[model samples]
Target: MEQISTDVAIIGAGPAGMFAVFECGMLKMSCVLIDALDELGGQCVALYPEKPIYDIPAHPAIEGAALIAQLEQQIAPFGCVKLLGRQVTGLAGEAGNFTLTTSMGDKISAKAVVLAAGAGAFGPNRPPLDGLSAYEASGAVRYYVKRREDLRGKRVVIAGGGDSAVDWALALQGVAAHIAVVHRRPKFRAAPESTAQLDALAAEGKVEMVIPYQLHALHGQDGVLQAVEVVDLDGAPRKLETDVLLPFFGLATELGPIAEWGLDLAQHHVTVTPATMETSISGIFAVGDIASYPGKLKLILQGFAEAAMAAHAIYGLVNPGMALHFEHSTTKGVPG
Candidate 1:
């Protein structure tokens, strides 16, 4: 096993983790960024590369892939070591001196650790349908729409009653030939404004709302989707012919090896100090969606703030007695 050392070991290459590199770099700290995915940007690049995000500060609107590209560029000057396509399976030692073991048989030693894992090791909650894997392999069934253009002119059957389901329905309005939303309840869990927009589209005959229904079975042969079978609460079955099935039942997230690292956890999220974003264990911090505290908002922008706090707090641990005279970005420009 190869051994590496750094001032801070950052897990997860998502938006928060990527930003943490810049924050730490600005403080003259070195970082080693690690993630399970082969690529950076986490779900932004992997799931909805084409999806437009509106809440990010500065830019009024930016697509997922574009946002990640900008973050990558922002952190490029940091020269942080990136360990992709591997997971950190073991964490040992204490504050100021920690050791980590990855699944690829590599060991990392760091003075501090930051966990920016957004919904650590996340995957879609696939419906329990027969031959689901076959259709998934052939792109007949998909959990995430990586690119909207892939579904152009195709009939789509969307399942679930969350923001993802409603948002995607609205996003694919002009792109898809036809769209039918399947939900187990009439009331959606999405934002009120988005739900209202979907209702307006449905009333205008641009979308179909199949409420109080759940996915029953998939009708297809050789991984080619032909129709989707849905049933109501009373067991009434209905078949909707479609070329694709997009199930947005949310993600099945697991902390995996992170759970055994002796950190305080609440509802599968790492409980952290609100001010410093530090976990129960010293030298280890948790931020982003995988972090939880009182009145914590699961927003990317909020995670960015947390990453800054964690980096600032970690400066003391990494530098011992040295004081971190904080300077505004205007005064302390990024490394050239």
Candidate 2:
């Protein structure tokens, strides 16, 4: 088994978790960022990279993927160690000293832990259809679209009524040769403007809206899709000949082993001390959406502030009896 050690172990690689690396670096602490997902950015990259977010202070609008890219660039100078595509299954030790074991059998030792797992380990809610996994393996079906060019000139069927399904249909307006959106209801959960745009595309004959339908079966071989079978409310089945299928039902989150780590959880979120962002455990801190407190607003900016506070508290815990004179980033440049 591979073994690694660092001053702090950050348990999530989302925006807040990545920001925690910058905060810890400012305190002259090295961090090892670990996440269950194969890539960083947590919910943003894994769920909806193209979705626009308007509430991230200072920026008028930004996509989920763009925000993650900027955060990754911001922490580049710090050289934060990353351990991705693995789930942390075991946590041992205490304040100023702890060890973590992942599902891949790697062990990490650290002086402190920052649990920035936003909504815990998240995964797309797969549609219930026989042979769905086979199609996913063959690249005929996808839950998340990493690149728009991949779907260019293809017949695509999107399933869902939410932002992902609606926004993607609009995004692929000119990219895909033919795009059809299948939803169980005519109403959508996406923003008004996005829905309006999708409707405009449908009116223009560039997109097809298959309302009140659910996926019945998949026809394909070796994960390659030949067509998709969908059924309407009256059990009327229709087969859509398409090259690709995208099912964006939503995401399902689970705390997994983090729940068994002895931390107090309320509504699947870790309870933390407001002043320090420390969990029930002394050196284990929780921030971002995974951390809960009285009147806590689940915002990116709020988590950023909590990360800074947790980093300061962790610095003291990692280095006992050492006086810390905090200074602004402008005062002290990035450490080499």
Candidate 3:
């Protein structure tokens, strides 16, 4: 029942949204940032934080979590209100005066809005596990790992082959008593270094790996997960015991309610007028993992570029009398 307003509203506090906040702060603009996760850094926080980020310029390699920490710390210098562990259930109104409702039942309005909720909403494919919903609570199982401390001394069994799986395998190294990574295929889809590190760890007997298999049954006792049964390659059956199970099969979806906003998605980038991250809705823009221009390169660096450009456009809409931050032709984000 509470209502608030600000100069700008950001739906996500991830990398793209974080960058947008940094710029908005520099511009002395009042803004509110909201995210489904409990903190800043979307993928970095929700999926895998300890994973190294190689594409960021000037920093050859950075852990996703560390990078997010740096971002959070840097943004702290600015006075911005952060709404974590909340989802924006609905958005309505014109460009300058928009209203937002959260799943937590709080409502707010803003002059302009930015949608930078990278691939988090539509989450990991929860392929029918039968009792999945029943066992999901009690922290015995989860789709993502937020804090490393939560994993200390606990045995974990992960299912997937993407970056999240590999990143977590490496992140939970010393903390987890034991880790078993399961994938439906023999080959992994993570970056070379990440996969290489996991491979080395497995070879050194640091972790257990299962290939060409997936979860068939999730067993629990006393209202807590006890173990899991998996079918391996060649239709072999196997069972693994652990305190936790993480299924990170990569972003198992498209846009959430944003798809209802109606934007043309072609090759990851929104079909938009070049240089403008604008979507079908005027004054509304889509950037980062959710958007790409006709030929713009899709990279973390590119997402920042899109976000920066989108900010400028929003600035123009909010205050045409003021100067825009950066030029459209120029790319200026964390140049990777």
Order of all candidates by lDDT, from best down to worst? 1, 2, 3
After superposition, which runs of candidate 2 have C-alpha atoms over 4 Å from their true positions? 1-5, 47-66, 220-222, 294-299, 322-324
lDDT of each: 0.94, 0.91, 0.77
- Model 1 clash pairs are none
Instruction: Give Cα distance to truth, residue 180, candidate 2, Å.
Output: 1.4
> TM-score, each model?
0.98, 0.87, 0.78
Tens digits of per-residue lDDT for model 1 on 155-210? 99999999999999999989999999999988999999999999999999999999
Candidate number with greatest lDDT: 1
Better of 1 and 3 by lDDT: 1
Quality of model 2 by C-alpha lDDT: 0.91
Q: What TM value does model 2 have?
A: 0.87
Per-residue lDDT of model 2, residues 1-336, tens digit only: 569889999999998999999999988899999998899898888767877778899889898999999999989989988999998999999987899999999999999999999988777899889988888887899988978888999999999998888888987878999999999899999989889999888888889999889999999888789999999999999999999999988889899999999899999999999999999988999999999999999888898999999999998887889989988889788877
Candidate with the greatest TM-score versus the true structure: 1
Backbone clashes in model 1: 0
